[model samples]
Target: MDVKKVLIAVDNSTCSEKAARVGYETALQFGAEVALVNIVEPVPANVNPDLTLAPVFLETYDNSKENSDMLLKEIELKFAQGTKTTYLSTVDTAAHGIIKQAEEWAADLIVIGTYGRTGLYHFLMGSVAEHVARKSACPVLIIPNKWEED
Candidate 1:
């Protein structure tokens, strides 16, 4: 298939770094435009139920957005330098945000990394890559966290 646009989903994890590298290489090979996206899930304010922690939650959300933007910038510089690239930072669930960005940008392919959480942790947190692969309209490339096993 012809890939004219590539969307890469990244986070603060090393797994994401690996995925970004692979995605960048693939995009370069295909001569495709690239977009890097980072999702910042909003901090839930219902943990206290009394609204007393609203300010703290707001601050946490702000910090998350800031960090996400920084991460996207760093990934773009490291992986997509000298290439046409777009950086996107959005507030949403990770999988949903990535899918949305890909769809909106009309991406031909999506690349993401799995955290490789297994057993109880996997069951509890679910897999963002799995969700995106299942729900995305276009092709998805999921890079496993193999270094974690070493």
Candidate 2:
């Protein structure tokens, strides 16, 4: 299939950085435009029992958005040369937001990173990569944290 558009999902992790790099390379190979996406999931309410701490929660949310923007900018500058790129951030579940963006952008392929969690860890913290791969309308490429060396 002709891949004219690519969607890359990233977060604040080494695994995400690796995925972004792979996505960039793949886009370059296909001469595809790219959309870099970051999802800032809302902090669970259970973390803060006191209702008076709402201000702190808002502050943390704002900081997270700012950080996500900064990270997306860095990735775009480093990897988006000679290609059209759009940076986007959303507040929701990472996998769902990614798949939604891909569908909205009409992306031909999606690239995401996996922590490679299994068993109990995977059960507790569901894998975003797995979700995207299964639910995305387009093809999904999952980059593992530990990649084979050339």
Candidate 3:
């Protein structure tokens, strides 16, 4: 698809490794650079319905970003097909963060793995990859999770 820049969203899972390899190969074939992205989902605040909880959630968000950075680094080390990697960690909603990273980097392709949820559960909870594909400006490629193999 004439990719000039690609973002591979990694989560330290086996599915992520496949997406990383695919992104790397596509980047190499298109003379593009690969950006490794990790989005930290902030932990929900402790509910009291009595006191303010934003402060607690704020701390959780900060910690989540740091954790995401560590995961991104670990994933980068596992990248085999290409050497080009830029890491990005954001304390935002997963889908939003991924889309923002792709936009900021001017990426031509967004590659990620689907958890492969189905049935009523999938309809109710939604999925990050599907959200990105529906909203992203660039092409979004979602590699189905290798459940049987991994």
Candidate 4:
């Protein structure tokens, strides 16, 4: 398939760093444009829908957005220098946010990292990478956290 556009999903984590490197390499190999996306989950509805408009929530949201922007910029500088790239930061559920960005951008492929959480933690938190892989319209490449090998 012609992968003209690649979406690299990242977070402020070592796993994401590894994924960023792999994703950049993949993009370089394919001569594809890249877009870095970071998802900042919004305050849950159970936290009080009214609080969504409160100053506290707004401040938290602003902080999250700023952090996401910084993370995306840093990843771009470190892994995707000299490549045509875009930064996408959104406040939504992680899986949904990544999927939405990929669909909106019409990405040809998606590269993401997984924490490899298992057992109860996996059950509780779920896997963003898995969700994205299953839901994305295009292909997905998941980078596992291989700290020992690194």
Q: Provide the overall lDDT of each model, using Cα atoms, as 2-decimal numbers.
A: 0.89, 0.88, 0.83, 0.90
Per-residue alpha-carbon lDDT of candidate 1 for residues 20-123, written as tens digits (9 for 90 to 100): 99899899999998999999886667556764666788788889888888888889888885779888888898899999999999999999998788999889
What local lDDT score does residue 105 receive in model 2, on the 0 to 100 scale?
Answer: 86
Instruction: Give TM per candidate.
Output: 0.86, 0.87, 0.82, 0.90
In candidate 4, what are the lDDT values of residues 10-108, reduced to their tens digit? 998999999899889889999999999999988743345664466778788889999989998899889886889999999888999999999999999
Among the numbered candidates, top lDDT falls to 4
Residue 2 local lDDT, model 3: 82
How far is 67's C-alpha from truth in model 1 (Å)?
1.5
Query: Model 2, range 45-150, lDDT digits (tens) per residue?
Result: 4345664546767788899899989999999887777678898888888888999889988999999989898999999989999989999889999999997536
In model 2, how large is the Cα lDDT of residue 1?
85
lDDT, candidate 2, residue 97? 92
5-78 per-residue lDDT for model 3 (tens digits): 88999886788778877877778778788899998876767866787776778787877778878787777676
Error of 2 at 111 (Å): 0.2
Which scores greater on TM-score, model 1 or model 4? Answer: 4
Candidate 4 clashing pairs? none
Candidates sorted by TM-score, best first: 4, 2, 1, 3
Q: CA lDDT of 140 in candidate 2? A: 94
Lowest summed lDDT across 10 adjacent residues in model 4 is found at 44-53
> Lowest-lDDT window of 10 residues in candidate 3?
74-83
Candidate 3 or 1, higher TM-score: 1
User: For model 1, what is the alpha-carbon lDDT of residue 95?
Assistant: 90
Q: Is candidate 1 or 3 superior in lDDT?
A: 1
